[model samples]
Target chain A: MNASLFDILTIWLQRPNFIAFIILFLWGLYIMIAHHNLIKKLIGMYLVQTSVIFFFITVSAKAGATVPILLNGESVDPALYANPLPHVLMLTAIVVGVATLGVSLALVVAIYRQYGSLDEEVILKQLGE
Target chain B: MRHHLPVFVFLLPFGMAICMPLISLVRPKWCRGLTMLALAAMTGLSVMLYSHVIAQGPIRYALSGWMPPLGIEWIVDGLSGLLLPLLGSLALMGVWYAGPLVTEGKGSIHFHLLTLLLVSGLSGMVMAGDLFNIFVFLEVSALSSYALVGSAGGRALVSAFRYLILGTLGASLYLLGVGYFYAVTGTLNMTDLADRLPDLLASKAVMAGFIFMLIGLGIKMALVPLHGWLPDAYVDAPDSVSPLLAPLVTKVALYAVVRVMYWVVGGEEVGETLPILTLSSWLGAVAALVGAFLALSQQELKRMFAYAGISHVGIIVMGVCLGNPTGFAGGIFYLLTDAVMQAALFYIAGTAFYSLGIRTLADLGRLRGQMPWVIGVLIVIAISMIGIPPSGGFFGKWYIILGALEAGNYIVVGGVVGATLLTLGYFVTIFERIFVDSVSSGPAVLAESPLSMRATMGMLAAASLVLGLMSDPMIRLILDHAFPG
Candidate 1:
């Protein structure tokens, strides 16, 4: 039991990628909530999405693994190949992220044209007036 | 040919939506006709599929001829069979009501296109049997709705932006949960996940996954504190946009919650192992009270109705969290009834805005004399919203109260009753304005609504009455087959 506990501790410490991913996610969330500018919010949204992508890629990684692609004449061993599903899924997620960014930017442009400000507080005040 | 009904129901709308831009360039008048035709066909298909499912059982179709655990699948069980027909009919009504209003402008084509896409996305969400596929369809629906809300321009732009930000956050959280599940189990199929989840119930990652998913979908369903975007999006949207969105979007999100909790994760874990259901029940009770109280303060008609919608959503959530078959069926019945009632109310509000320029209680005082038909329908819908006898809303509340009593949950029963009285309180204000107050002396600037709009509103109002009278059969049908026994 003690050995297993130590093993868990070692694995947790070695997984710095996961820690970085969480930090990036929280940082993005903070910007999204705290920033007054709409553009900054959109940028923060992009950062949040990027962190998710990074986490997925990190999850797909295996120690002592090679590329997922197969060599034509080589004998195949499944344990040596990294999982490919997360990469494919993240590709779709990236496409969805781009589409969302496009829509959000268009909306910001329209809001800027109408209220003449990108700050949410200014826009709300103008709308009230 | 009959086996492909699930695919065709969504595919038909998607195909028509994609073809709309070209059709608009050639003949714009045909755009409305085509959209109506597509929704009507989808309605017919859903009815046929529901009948088939009742006769046989759940139908699962594997995409590209690959079986489950390998390829994407679409399933039409009791839940989807019931919801698909409701969604199709309501969407058809939304389009029919918007026909005359959208036709008067240049952007009518785009409106029809976005509306069709929204319908397709909703249909896809209901029928999808895979978790990842649900996310894809969710994005499809969310993206289209954000654009549809902003299609009116002006103040709608800012509201739509807020919706976009929050909606994307919700979607991101959901995806992160899905990622966690994949990391642990490496499967996305709902049935497969259900099979694997029993053994993994003790894992922290699995627990975190369920928590993340519930919170994400909670925001989408507008459960109280996370409902900041709904009133603004509904109020500032175009007159035609609110009716389509107000009834369907949040309900679909709730459907997703049902699918995830009962199907993917299994209710035993959610009820016994985790405190999710108990927590949801408390939150739902609080939301029911808070939403109704907030509704009491709104002066505008649509904003008031929007708050009332939040209250109804809370009631349905509370019912589902009871973790019993009776409670689950009550939740489904309330969902059906609320969709009909809320859509009819929004349609009436839209009609009032279009025909009489009515926005507040004062504007409604003189409306009785000019537009008796619209005002009459509004009264029936308002009564239903207050859960009066002989209306669909009463039956929904009745079942929920019975379920809560059976579960020995007295606080929830009290919450339901208190919410009902508060609902009556707010709706009575509208009643007094329409029925008792004297007409103002100002000249009438608008005429009565077109025949199509009135006819659709009348049908929806009648549906509420009919559904109330037929509540027993509806409950039986939903209870017998919805969740795995």
Candidate 2:
């Protein structure tokens, strides 16, 4: 339940990517759970997913490294290039996020067509459940 | 060719999935035949793969001859080898039962297409040796299953939407956890992670990472306190989809937990830094109790079975968390047998919905004498679920309870055994309503389920029976493949 000053400072300032990820994740979780409108809930989901994508990109970053490309005329030093695995992994994550958004949005459309409302309480009321 | 069986399990279905749209274009009718051929091949390939794994040990195939720590990898050990055949056959049976119910509506091809994709995703999840690859396959399976659940339209759409939110949340958390571990170990391969995790287990970041994965897969597995999406999804899913989604969706998540945590992280025994195992076993206990009690109050059969599923998942996880070979084997045994039994039960549920319009518990009273011999199969399955001897469910629980006793975890012991009595209460209530209680309304004569439907259900029920009666060899098979080298 308690942390040292070093831990606090690390969380607040040093680990920019992790701190930002935590904030965005909790914010999005709030919007997704507390919002009544289905569209807003989906927006919240997007924020959470984007936060994850950012975190992965953070993992791939290095201060003095070039892009993960091989130079035709130069010998390769791995440390000169930023890690590409995390970046490549994020591309797949981004596609999956978009695909899920599409599916959820289609479901929202179907719900609206059936019940004429996007508000959770309103739809549940209409269903009398 | 036999050596390629592991990759073939995933690629066959994926290739068939891509070919589906084209087949529908050239000849819509051929879609069904193509689907049957694809799954039959997948199942056959998996059976061969299982034998190979048993004989030759775990198979790890590196893509393009690149060895693990850098390139993508796929591994099928004892546990995954057993599950592949079971899930493949479930898909095969699911298609046969779904044959009559799948309407020739516009884009009927979507049904078969999504089914194949789901199977492919599931197989990929089972075999994936890379953490990020597992996440990708998890999404593929989740996305396809969403479309399948919402395929019935209307209320099903609403349920699917809610599941989407929770499912995406779960995936993001899982990815975050993977990132945390990668940060610590600088690797994503399971074998590499295991080698690095022991020393890092005491680090706060690694502990947090473990909790994140637990929460993430918890949502996916529909554990108690995080199961808000499951019952609604199951009840509202199309009858055709339930047979596939109900049995495999949560079961696979449970498998991921066992594979990653115990198989990779070395369970609680390997790392003494945290009592995360004990903590999870308690959570499983709570889930078992809460799920059973809620199931007791359900008036609809599908809804009841959904709650019961939550309880069984809890029991299986509890077994695995015991950190012993007997318990792990029991968990695997229950998982394989339960997939077959749940698939068969959902088929009967679909039959009732499609033909008899029997949705409520009261509607079962009319099935007294007029019902086809399918009632006999239902009795067999219900008895197994009730944990009677000579049935799969009984032996599964027996090993779990025995393991719990050995570990002195009385709470888990109570939860596992107490659920059996509650299970009896529900099954007896259903039977009493069917054969004993007098019907108040409904039709006097009942329509019979098709021979194909009846035949599939009978086969699965018999499999459950055989799984229990023949527990010795099967348990030995599981132990040999899944445990110490």
Quick one: best lDDT, which candidate? Answer: 1
lDDT of 2 by residue, B186-231 (tens): 9999999888888888788888887898899999999999999999
The 10-residue segment with the lowest total lDDT in model 1 chain B:
B440-449
DockQ scores for all predicted structures: 0.78, 0.88
- TM-score, candidate 2, is 0.97
lDDT of each: 0.88, 0.86
Report how far residue B483 has shifted in candidate 2, in Å: 1.8
Q: Model 1, stretches more than 4 Å misplaced?
A: A1-12, A73-75, B442-446
Interface root-mean-square deviation (Å) of every model: 0.6, 0.8
* Model 2, C-alpha of A81: deviation from truth (Å): 2.8
